[model samples]
Target: MLRAYQFRLYPNKEQQSYFANYFGSVRFIYNQMLADKIDHYKKTGKMLKNTPAQYKEEFLFLKDVDSLALANAQLNLEKAYKNFFREKSVGFPKFKTKHKSKASYTTNNQSGNIRIEDGKIKLPKIGFVTIKQHRDFDGVIKSCTISMNKAGKYFISILVEQETPEWLPAEHKIGIDLGLSDFAITTNDSDESVKYANPKCLDRSEKKIKKAQRALSRKQKRSKNQEKARLVLAKK
Candidate 1:
C-alpha cells in the first residue's frame, strides 16, 4: 500500500534558494522538452525521445539541482502526452510560466537520500530542512514532492510504501445519509438514528475572508503592498 503524508517545511535562506533553483530547473526542462517534442513532430511526423541528460552540457545550472527532479519532469511530460492521446478532452500540454505555474518539484528516494531525523528532513542537493511533522508514520520512503504556495509557505508531501493491515470482522453495520442542515444521519441495527450538526466552517470565517479580499482589491496591482495583501487574503 502507498500513503502520502504532508508536512510544513521551514528552509533557511540557502535552502530556500536551492528550492527556487530546483523549481525553476524542473519547469525549464519540462517546457524545453515539450517544445522540442512538438517541433520534432511537426517536421518529422514522429515523436521525439528526449532526456534531461541531453541538455546538461548546454545548461550547466541543471547539474546543480537534483537529477531525480529533472527525470521526474521528463516523466511528467510523457504522462501529459499520453493523456492527450488517450483522451481528446484532455488537452495537449502547455508551457509553464513563472508567474502562473505551480512552484514544485518531485524527487524519488535513493539509498536513503530522503529521510526524517532530529526534527528535520534530508533532501537531495539540499541539506536537512526543518519540518513540522504533526504525526509520525511507519513506512519505507518512496518519493517526495516539495511545493510553495502563493502565500510563500513551503510544504513537502512524502510518499511511502507499507504493508496493508489485516481487517477485523465487523460486529455491526450502519447506514449514513448525508444532508445540508445536518452533517450526517446514521442509523444502526437497532433503528436508532443520530444526527450530526453541520459545523458551518465557511460561515464562521466568511467575514474575515471578505474583508481581506476587499483590502487586496484596493491595493495597486503588481506592487509589494498588493502582494502582501494577497498573501494575507490567502492566509485568511
Candidate 2:
C-alpha cells in the first residue's frame, strides 16, 4: 500500500529562496501548458500537446529547478485535462497565480535521487536540509514533495510503498454515539455501555476571549496596536 510521511522542514535562508524559485517554476510550467492547450483548441480546434522539454527554450529560467518537477507539472496538467473529459462532473483546469496558490513542487526519487539520513533530506537542486522526523517508518521511499504554507512554514511529504498486512475487522471494537449533553456514549465489544461527559473548556475561556475580541474591534486596521491585539487574541 502507499503511505506518506510528512515532516516539518527547517531550511536556511538561501534554501528557502530556492524553494520559492522551484515552486514558481513548476507553477509557471503548469499555467503555460494549460494556456497553450486552451489557445490551440480555440484556434485550430485541436489540443496542442506541449511537453516540459518543449518549454525549455522559451523558459530558460525554468532550468533552475529540478527537471523532474517540471515533468511532473506537465503530467499533472495532462491528468487534469483527461479527468475533465472523462468525468463529466469535473471542471476545466484553471490557471495558477503566484501568492494565490499554495507553494509546492514534487520530485521523483528514482535511483536514489532523494534520500533521508541523519535528520537531513537530500533534495534536487537543494542540498541537505534539516528536518524533524518525529516518527520512524519502514518502506521504500518513492517520491518527495516539498511545500510551504501561507504561514511561512515549510514541509516535505515522503511517499512510501510498504508491504502492509491486509486489514481485518477488530474483534474488540468500540462504537461511540455522540450526544448533545454528554461527549459520547461508547458501546464496547462486550456490549457494555459507557457515558463520557463533555469538557466545557469553552465556557471557562469565554469571558477572556470576548474581552480580547472587543479590544481587537476598537483598534484601527493596519495599526501596530491592532496587530498586537490580534496576536494577544490568537494566544488566548
Candidate 3:
C-alpha cells in the first residue's frame, strides 16, 4: 500500500530563495516538456521516445540555463506527465506563479533524500523542515512534494510504500437516523442521545447577516456610507 504524509516547512532566507527559483525552473521545464510532447504527438501521432541518458543530459543542461541543482527533477516531471495522461488530475502540469495561493515544488525519489527523523524532515534544496509527526511511518519514502496553501502556510507531502492491514468480513450491519435535537436513533435502541446541537448558532448568524444586508441596501450606492455599510456587512 502507498500513502502520503504531509508536513510543514520552515526554510531560511537563502533556502527560500533557492526553492522559489527551483520551483519556477521546474515549472518552465514542465511547460517545455508539455509543448515538446504535443509537438511530438502532432508529428508522429504517437508518444516521443527518450532514453534515461537523454533525460540525464537534459537535467544537466539546467547548470547553463539557471542556478541550483535540478537532478532527478525530470523523473518527477515525467511521472507527472504520466499521471496527467492517465487522467489522475484535471489538467497537465503548468507554470507556477509567485503571487498564487499555492506555490511550491516537488522532488523525485532519486538525487535527494526525503528523510524523516524525530518529527522533522530533510528535503533537497530546502533543508530541515519540522512537522507534527502524528504516527510512525514504517515504509520506504518514495517522493516529496512541497506546496503552500491559501492560508499562506507551507507543507511537505511525503509518499511512502508499505503493507496495509487486511480488513475483516462484516458480521452484521445496522442503520441509524440522525436528528437535530437528538444525535441518533438506533433500530434496536428506544432511547435517543443528545450528542449534537440543533444548529441554533447558524440560524442566529444568518439572521444577523440578513439584517446587515438590509441595512446596507438602504444606503445609496457610490456613497461613503454605502461603502462603510458594505464593509460592515462583509465583516458579518
Candidate 4:
C-alpha cells in the first residue's frame, strides 16, 4: 500500500533559490515538450520522442537543477497526453505558465536518495531541508513532491510503500445523518443519538476575509503592493 504524508518545509536562502530553479525548470520542460509534441503531430502525424537530456546542451541552466525533476516533468506530460487520447472529455495538455501554473515538482527515490533524518528531509541536489513532521510512520520512501502555495508557503508530500494494517471486524454499525445546521447526527444500536455542531468557518472569518479583499482591491494593478495584497487575500 502507498500512503502520502505532507509536511511544511523551511529552506535556507540558497535552498529556496534552488527550489525556484527546480520549479521553473520543471515547468519549462513540460511546456517545451508539449509544444514539440503538438508541432510534430501537425507535421508528421506521429508523436515525437523527446527527453530532457536532449535539451540540456541547448539550455545549460537546466543542468543546474535536479535531473530527476526534469525527468518527472516528462512523465507528467506523457500521462497528460495519454489521458487526452484515451478520453476526449479529458482535455489536451496545456502549456504551463509561471503565473497560472501550479508551483510543484515530483522526483522519485533512487537508492535512498530521498529520506528523512532528525527534523529534516534530504532532496536531490537541494541537500537537507528543515521539515515540520507532525507525525511518524514506518515505510520505504517511494517519491516526494515539493510545492509552493499562493501564500508562498512551501510543503513536501512524501509517498511511501508500507504494509497495510489489518482492520478488525465491526461489531455494530452506526447510522449517520448529515445536515447544514448540524454537521452530523449519529445513532448507534442502542438508539442513543448525538449531534455535532456545525462550525460555521466562513462566518468566523468573514470580517478578516472582507478586509483582505478590500486591501487587495485598493492596490494598483501589476504592482508589488498588489501582489502582496493578493497573497494576503489568498491566506485569508
Worst 10 residues of 3 by lDDT: 63-72
The worst-scoring run of ten residues by lDDT in candidate 2 lies at: 227-236
Tens digits of per-residue lDDT for model 2, 51-100:
98898888899878799999999999999998988996899998998857
Clashing pairs in 2: none
After superposition, which runs of candidate 3 have C-alpha atoms over 4 Å from their true positions?
40-46, 50-102, 110-112, 168-194, 198-236
**Arranged by TM-score, best first:** 4, 1, 2, 3
Q: Pick the TM-score winner.
A: 4
Question: Model 1: clashing residue pairs?
Answer: none
lDDT of 3 at 2: 93
lDDT of 3 by residue, 1-236 (tens): 99998766766677667666666665656556667777898899887644234443666744432222343445656677778879955587665455442465566565446687766687654567676676677888887777765444567788888889799987655457788676565553435433544557788999999998899899998899987887777667
Better of 1 and 4 by TM-score: 4
- TM-score of each model, in listed order: 0.93, 0.82, 0.58, 0.94
Give the candidates in order of lDDT, highest first: 1, 4, 2, 3
- Tell me how far the alpha carbon of residue 63 in candidate 1 is from the true structure, in angstroms, after superposition: 0.6
TM-score of 2: 0.82
Compared with the true structure, what per-residue lDDT tens digits does model 4 show for residues 1-236? 99999999999999889899999999999988899999999999998989999999999999898898999999999999989989989898999999899999999999998988999999988889999999998999999999998988899999999999999999998999999989999999999999999887878699899999999899999999999999988888
Point to the candidate with the largest lDDT: 1
Off by over 4 Å in 4: none
lDDT of each: 0.95, 0.90, 0.65, 0.93
